[model samples]
Target chain A: MDKIEEKELWPEEKSLMKAEISRRKFITSATLAALGLAMTPYATLAAAPSNKPVNFASFVEINTTINGQNMKMKLDPRTSLLDLLREQLGLTGSKKGCNQGACGACTVHMGKDRINSCLTLAAQIDGKEVTTIEGIGSETEFHPIQVAFMEHDGYQCGYCTPGQIMSAIKVLEEDHAGSDAEIREWMSGNICRCGAYKGIVEAVKSVRDETYDKKLIKRTQQKVS
Target chain B: MNPFQYSKAKSADAAINGYMEHDNTAYLAGGTNLVDRIRRDVTHPDYLIDVSELPFSKIEKIEGGLRLGAMASNSDTADDENVKNDYPIVSEAILLGATDQLRNKATNGGNLMQRTRCSYYMSPHFACNKREPGSGCDAIDGHNRILSVLGTSEKCIASYPSDMCTALAALDAVVQIQTPNGGKRSLPLVDFRRLPGDSPEIDTNLKEGELITSIDLPESSKAFAKASHYLKVRDRHSYAFALVSVAAALVMENNMIKDARMALGSVAAKPWRDQEAEAMFIGKKPSRELFEKIAEKTMEGAKGYGENDFKIELGKRAIVKAFMKVAGLS
Candidate 1:
């Protein structure tokens, strides 16, 4: 892991870190006040502020189940789910393309529904289940969707592959991959700047067809039994 | 992003009080738009009141129609059996917007409260009157290919960018709001959003600390229930804002139009509905020619900005297309 030394901090970086510390201190005092402690601690801290200007906001502790693992983390109220996933949890499989909802590169599963992690607040996921691309499959074994994408050459740059796969899995789960047109419309949110949409669509269709055939085989076997 | 105080409100009263106690406080639900705006530094609320956990997430069938809770996810509402079977236009409109991912996170009230996607309004680099009142609007002469043409004022010309709201306007839905004083009031969807006028900063008629509770859709005739349609023409097939969209519902009796409701989007500050044009269809036989005439009447006084002049024609065709679809002509 890369670490930044205190002496190597840039002028702006140092100021930002100072502000962050002060903000954390203020949050600690505010939390105590909310717990029936007197507000004197918060008032004194606000009045005794140091050289660096600090805009203190409350920090929220979120208990979320990510990748089937229950974890609790204190997050700034403004932290987005994408930042919490990549920066704090070190799960960087979900790439941030456009932080705005315009691009779906940061797609992940919240329960059964896929959501743009960049647009979702980290605090909003309290007590919710989050599934990132890393959780979709293991390094030793690939999910069928990942294997299908590899077999069909579904990506070029691979920057958006994680989001594409996440969205595709949800597409099949939602029963929206019934036809080529349906696949295209359902997967339209995850944009591939490489213009590998033709192969992407082919991969999704192949998975859908394979899954359907397997279902048929299982049904026939059940009937025979 | 600017740091702001955050609190999770346990009840509706707590949410309202949290907002009213602060000068610049915003209710947080879904956070799809509010978070994005905060990241861009376009909106800087001093405090955030989390209302996502409030008991406003149900979609129930009322005595007359459907009542959609404010916090109900757009995907759930669109996929509801009742909405899909009875108000399919609303379902179609909701599905046409954003994506499956956005629909899952976006709540009904959040969708209604979403700000315009106009480049000038969203980007802080440009002067946007809607962002900073009296600062001046750069889109008035700047790049306005996606701005509104109807109901635009010189002060601002941002288009309302919600497909669900467009359908709600055509459906004559009512917005239920919880006043700060613990009172409740209802406003029709059409009257819920306001025109740009001089104060473009004010997007809706919602007052400070007034929380949107639910939206109610009134019962309509079977003809309207069966013959409603939403048509959106955009730069792409999906995941794009509408260049011009239309939501039309009609009731036909004996080959004559008995009633009609039409509302347009991306052409005004709010859903642009021409009641006069809708009234013109009553007692008249539905035809392409009549639809064209009605479209023309609806586009009257629609002055477009330089780049968006094509919307005048595109909006007309979209209205006609929607009408044709509802009439089962095409």
Candidate 2:
């Protein structure tokens, strides 16, 4: 929450700032030996130059909600959403295959729509909601799409499975998976290196058909009731 | 990615001011293209002013036609009822591009500002005039299967890989820009992108700190709207970039062509449009012979490098196919 003023610190001041931290740590034990002033950890840290700045960049505070959980962190401006998820939050479910938009292994939901997290800057998604694979399901209870993938053997190597499932859920939600061909066309961004096209298509198709049937039955039940 | 100062702009003026204050600054919208290049180290900016929150995310029916705000996502624009009905070619072209997820994040202005996808231009290991002014071009002799065949120069052969721009060209769209000096100007979409002349580094005619506010699609007649198609030929049926794409719109009256507009993509530095070729279609009957002649005329000045020589024939076939589909001949 602390906003540090970003201005270039002089060389002597930078070295003195570094020494001041070490001297403060040493003085914490030798309190009675010297100037007789005790400083708390917070006070010592706060004593450092509040306006200390780098050459051009500084840490940025990104406030966002991830999988319904509110999160706030100070991150480098260059950090991407994928890196924030995988490295910072330890949400490794989103694989970093290419780290580019070409491969959709790092797909996640930015609010209601899915996007390539690798291409999304962490700071840019400030105040936005992000949903990753961990948010979709856990080992105890799998999402319908995850269950379908398991039943249909939607993956071989399984590196691209998370992204595929995320995209597949979006495809059904967007009403784009009317058929196997349509599913493949819509899910083209997520590439399966093992070439598990057959199973992926089958998994998406099964879920799409089942979801449609469920809605149909609900309508029928409503009419009967 | 290099470190940069990041700030979100609340308004167009704020964004322009932020951009003007920094020499090496980029406006962040969608971040699909800019962030990708930043990660690749092909582009380095000292400041990134986030303009995604600017008040430019509207798609309204204007007096003449549609006015699409620069920040409107490609997905929203493509799925809009008015766009799908009135400008089906635009919808189809946007849909034919990157996958569903990408369309969700990619904005209309960002799509127009997409840099070339040439391998040499993207990788720092290779020399690209577009990336570095005097570095020389490796794509001229390297694997340039996807490079431009038209509107290329000795300095750069990178193709402008945007399907939406091709459709915008056919629709006669105009780009509305907010200049740094608090002025506004509009330019035709065809003139918005510059050909790879001596300065391949300059992609568009836009000046520094000039923010694109919106794009205006002029209203077309009922016939032109009805008979329009965006045909994209690619290595894969799905997310791959187009090998050769064509956006064709024709107005026909009683099996005779009344007006025609055609634009080609993936074969030029800019969206290739030949007025002479389109003019040949006017006043002519809808026939295979006329379509073939128009296709040939469109490919008149197209010169291909060794690896991309197939694009010439592919472009010709794509033009004929798009014309036929729009004319409802086949």
Candidate 3:
């Protein structure tokens, strides 16, 4: 969980910083100033003397609920939410296909809405709740969307399934899955290179129809209390 | 991505102060485009001032139209009852671009401030004046199928890449800004983005250390609210950048155009709006012949490089199609 300590840096990170400072050709006093800034826990890396003094934090501590588990950790400001979930928390259900937002392979639910975990920084989720693919269903029992994907043969390579399923759940919840065309348009963000569009559309369509039917079927006549 | 300092600001003034105090700083909002560019090494910031939590996330109904908070997510802004009902073009444009997850994370202000998606500008290997001031522009001679056709200079030809801003231009939206000296100012969204002239590095008129607080949609545009259409033509039907797009709105009265607003996207340095040309549609009736003439007038001086010459014709067709849809004609 500890990537780099705040006050006492890991030996490797310390060596890296020393190498960086030496490469920058700073004067001995400036090197001391840089090391001094590093030693001061959570201090931003000091730049050249001419630059303005930066007061930003290098280490950000966040308290967030990830996959239904509360976690409090100090993370590097550069760590993304996807990296935090996959590397630090050991939840790799969210795949990082394109680290950028272009690929929906890193899709996850942040609270009630879906977001690209790769684009979200760990610090941004300080007080928020995040749900990865692992958080969606049990081992013995899969979520309805997962079941629908299996039944409908929604995936080919299975690499993009987690992201597709995550996106599909929101598409259905948003009532955007009224038809196959609508599903394709709404799920456009998540690209499946396997060209499994036919199955993905069918899986979402089947679930959407079932969800609508359940609203009427599951409605039990309320008896007077 | 480069190692950088990051901090969350609690207020607008604090955010501005944080930005002003740093030698090289960027205000992090949605992080949808900023984070991606950081990963691509196209943009490098020494310090990131997180203004996402600055309490500017409201989408309030103003006296005439709506006051969209700068921090409001694009998804929330697009799905708002008022935005969907009164500003349907904005909603449609936002939905047409980006995916559901991106829409949820990209903020309204960040959408306005997003950099160009030009291949030359995005990669460090290529020469882009926008990325580096003195560096020559590779897109001028390279594969510029997606580059701008109008308002382009020899220095840069990158096209502005926001469908939402294209719609806002038609609506005549005003961007409210918080200056670094604790003052506030507002400019029309049309004037907010600058054409890539001698200095392509400067994207907007926003000065250094200033923050955008909100965007105002005026009441005057409400007339076009119902009869507006956003037509985007891209390589893919969804989740792709527009090759040529148009935002057209008409306040029609008894089969006659009372007033009209039109703006073209992905064809110019900024959203290409010719108010002088649009004025021609004010007194005319809806006709295919009239729409054709207006489309031609819109693309009068649009010049294209090798791979993007098709954009001129595509832009004209998109403009006419958007007009036809808004006019409720075939």
TM-scores for every candidate against the unseen true structure: 0.87, 0.87, 0.87
Worst 10 residues of 1 chain A by lDDT: A40-49
The best candidate by DockQ is 1
* CAPRI tier of model 3: incorrect
lDDT of every predicted structure (CA atoms): 0.85, 0.83, 0.84
Note the residue pairs that clash in candidate 3. none
lDDT of 1 by residue, A137-162 (tens): 66445677887787778999999999
Model 2 agreement with the true structure over B222-263: per-residue lDDT tens digits? 346788999999988889899889999988788888899899
RMSD, candidate 2, Å: 14.4
Indicate whether candidate 1 or candidate 2 has the larger DockQ. 1
lDDT by residue for model 2 over A1-225, one digit each (tens)? 122222332222222343454555443423422343321111122212224344434678878999889988887888899999999998998999877687799999998899999989899889999999989864445677877787778899999999998999899898988877888889999999999889889888888777422322211122221
User: Residue B205 lDDT in model 1?
Assistant: 95
Query: Per-residue alpha-carbon lDDT of model 3 for B259-308, expressed as tens digits?
Result: 99998888877887898889989878998889999888888988889889
Candidate 3: residue B299 lDDT (0-100): 87
lDDT of 3 at B33: 93
**What lDDT score is found at residue B31 in candidate 2?**
92
Q: Give stretches of model 2 more than 4 Å off.
A: A1-57, A138-140, A211-225, B221-223
